[model samples]
Target: MKISNETIIEMYEKMVKIRKFETRAMNLFAEGQVGGFVHLYIGEEAVATGACESLRDDDYITSTHRGHGHILAKGGDMKYMMAELFGKETGYCKGKGGSMHIADATKGILGANGIVGAGHNIATGAGLGIQYKGTDQVCACFFGDASTNQSTFHEGLNLASTWKLPVVFICENNGYGISVSQARHQNITDISQRAVSYNIPGITVDGNDVFAVFEAVQEAVARARKGQGPTLIECKTYRWRGHFEGDPTVYRPEGELEQWKKKDPIPRVEKYILDNQVMTQAEMDKLNEKIDALVEEAVDFALASKFPDISSAVEDVYTDIVEEGRSR
Candidate 1:
């Protein structure tokens, strides 16, 4: 449980990067620079940072629609992500997959799914593959609380548990499925309790605390690497933004967001660093300035990049299209 100072600093940097990136993305969306539905991961930075920090570069992860944080935490390049947001050809998916569908197999990021609960089955499959190969690798599945209601959640968890697949299910209980609050959507308060049905270890942790999340996921990951099977970790967090950009969020009670804002994960980590003397105030300020400049550079790069040529639209779409055409 001894985390190195380097790792802690890295985690802090990633959290700051996510916050700055999402904030800039919000502004870009408001300015109409980004197209399509954009989900901002503003308040829940700690969960993704802590979880991904516990994983190796070769470890697999499946992302949700609100996935920029997950991708960035897993070492995704900001330039490519920003380019994809801008729909430029230099994007991760060559501009075809925008915010919701970016993927980097080299980094073990299967891709971010637009469909709710889609990552569950994908992570299970990846776990099964690792089991077949007899590797010590594990797959971490990230999803929202509402996704647990989907059939894929039950099916994936059940199969992974029964087969002892190496997968760690990370549920980010953000307290709402779009506008419907957690109380309205599910009867249970703690989503981790559902793991009993699958016969796997389940625990709930304060997602706002970076170290808490890191410790929980790190243990789960170690268990999986030992071929012990999967675990369910419920992160009780909150999203400061609406489900997506431009949502009025009328269903939320007055002052609810402000209350959650009081527990904002980025500031919590900043306070921890300062209190623990992990970094001097001057060092922290310099880190923040560097991250801000990096995010700004990403925006500039995306804007300067060219859009995909219309003629090349069908190029990467269908793998067998050329063969089929030749046969015809």
Candidate 2:
């Protein structure tokens, strides 16, 4: 938990970036600039930011469907993210992967899977790779509470723990798995508490509190890289948006949404940074303006980028071409 003033400032900026990016992307989606399900990671910024602050440049991370926050926190580029959302050819996957399947290898972001809990196994496999290669790099897998019910969640954690793999299992219990409340989903109130069964240390943190999440992750990651074992960190947070872009969420309770809104990570981190003298308020304002302008430019770039030609629509099907060749 030895976080310096510099690290706090970076975390604050990253949380702000996530909120603004999600907000702008929602507006663009409404304007018809994007297609497919756009699940905004508006409320869960601090979870990704805080957890990933513990990772290094070479450390890998896998993301869930609602994963813009993880990608940004893991140092993903805004221009490519915007382009991918817009379905432009300049996207991370050259516009093939869309909103849910964004992957940036250069940043060590393995990918964001559309399927629930898919990234869990992928992250486990990555930890195995790290173990095999004898690298000190760690892997952080971001999954929602709904994903915990999925088989991969069990399989991945079991494998990671058995092998004592260097992986951080982050469960973002945002209180809902697309309209199903935590009360309805699991009997256990604290998802982190389940780590005891796996023989790994688990911690529950206020996901809205960026510093707390960051500190907890720092410890878990240090332990992981030391080859001790994986850690299960359940971040108690909320998603500001609906399950997807077009769902009018009549499912959520009235005051609960407003209650979580009071815990917005951006302002909380901003105030913490300023009040702690980590950075001046003027500097924070200037940084925000810079980030906003960068996002705006990314949007424009995405709009101006070329679309993938229809001729190659089926070109990326690897097995199809292999099967055709085998027929010869």
Candidate 3:
């Protein structure tokens, strides 16, 4: 499917936004401006950009720990995200949930989970909701390679398949699950093959190629809207940073990082934009400037925002529970 130039430009912008946000996040975490651990989505930009681009505003997605890219691509507000990372009252979860738990229900982003393979059940549940509501909406579940081994992965896929839930399982096989490589952990070469058990369409594509991902997901979303069932899309990509920001990644093979760096998705997409003349260099530069200013503004907003009041700590935990001794 030929995506429009406008959409392509928007995709490019989203990819850049993810790159810039994570890059800044790395710095902020190091400088102690942001608390908690941060997992950078430095090289895996295309998968989220392409997949989310095919989604509508009401469509749902469950994100992984390395989920800033998914949220940004799905129209998450940067200021709120920055504030969340800064643990300010203006955050998405009012400073209660940190980086790995940022959620925007209005935007259909369920939440970025810290637990491995936790999103599978959530995405399937969202799909069930869509089916029950008789809506054309679908949920894209983004997970890492290691998540495929989790019991939730099997259980969720089984139920979704049996019920014909409209959930697209997007596995980002970045070669490593925390510190373990795919070869050392799993015997299967392609994680997509797991879908065979569920009798769903499973395919692997170059996660670095946004077009490949977009077209594949477009087809899957079409099939889902027609009540066809779920699809498993394994995106073979790499994570530039270690599992978390501070991980030295000693387990990585010599020169492996350099090898994957050659496949960086952002530069390749930028090249595609230039080759297609989707926008002139001047226009692209203007877009970059706009995104840069936006990131800076988000940082400023987070810095200026006040921390949540002490009473707010006990507020959002349970639906209706209140602290016995605490008075508001």
Candidate 4:
């Protein structure tokens, strides 16, 4: 599949945005400006950026805990995300849902899941809804390698396959399920192989290659839109940071992360752009400066935003039972 130069540049920009956002979030966490468990998607930017580029604005996506990258790629505003991290009322969830639970329904983001493999069922249900409505919409579900072990994964895949639901299961096999390495957690080398039982197309790709990921997902999205069953795409990538911020990552071998850094997706894309003469070095530099400023502005916006008022704690939480009874 031939991707246009414009699409490639956009994908590169999105990858850089994810890198910058996560880098800022990391520093903020260390400086005590942000709270809660923050999982950084430093090394896995390509997977999200490429996959999201293949999706339409009306298409749906379900993200995992390390979801900031996914949301941003799917057109999430950095200002609102930064506010949510700061627990400000101006956030997407009104300062209620933190790092792992941001959602933008208007943009087709079905919320990031805190529970492992929970997106499987949610994406399946969304696919079912699309099928019922007879729309060409498809839901792309993102999860980690270890999440495949969860019961929801099997159940969701089985049901979606049986019904030929328009869902795409994207497994980001980032080598570890939290602290446990892939070899330790699951015996299978390729998580995509799991799709065999469900009789769906299963593919494993180099997650670090943005174009490769884009092509694979574009094909899968097309298939889903055509009413075919879900496709399992295992992106074999690695996360530079620990499972969450402040995690020392003592479990990893000393040289493993350093080795993965050699294959950094951002640099790879940069090299492609320069080699192809797609953008001059000066243009790239200007783009970087612009992204840096945008991220800084988002930080400023979050800091200036107010926190959610304590009095309204139960406002969006429960139904107004008294009002409902009176009305009835």
Which tens-of-lDDT digit does each residue in 82-178 have in candidate 1? 9999999999998999999999999999999999999999999999999999999999999999999999999999999999999999999999999
Please report how far candidate 4 places residue 247 from its true position, in Å.
Answer: 0.5
Global lDDT scores for all candidate models: 0.95, 0.90, 0.93, 0.94
Indicate the residue-level lDDT of 64 in model 1. 92
Best by TM-score: 3
Runs of candidate 4 exceeding 4 Å displacement: 319-328
Question: Model 4, 83-117: lDDT tens per residue?
Answer: 99999999998899999999999999999989999
Clash count in backbone of candidate 4 = 0
**Model 3 score (lDDT):** 0.93
CA-RMSD of model 1: 2.4
Residue 244 in candidate 2, Cα distance off native in Å: 0.9
Candidate 2, residues 1-328, lDDT tens digits: the string is: 4579888888888988898899999998898878899999999899999999989889999998998999999999999999999888899888888989899888899999999999889999999999999878999999999899999999999999999999999999999999899999989889998898889999999988888888888889999898887999999999988999998989998898999999888888777776778888889889999989989998999989998765545666784672223222
lDDT of 4 at 15: 96
lDDT of 3 at 181: 95
Q: How far is 271's C-alpha from truth in model 2 (Å)?
A: 1.7
lDDT of prediction 2: 0.90
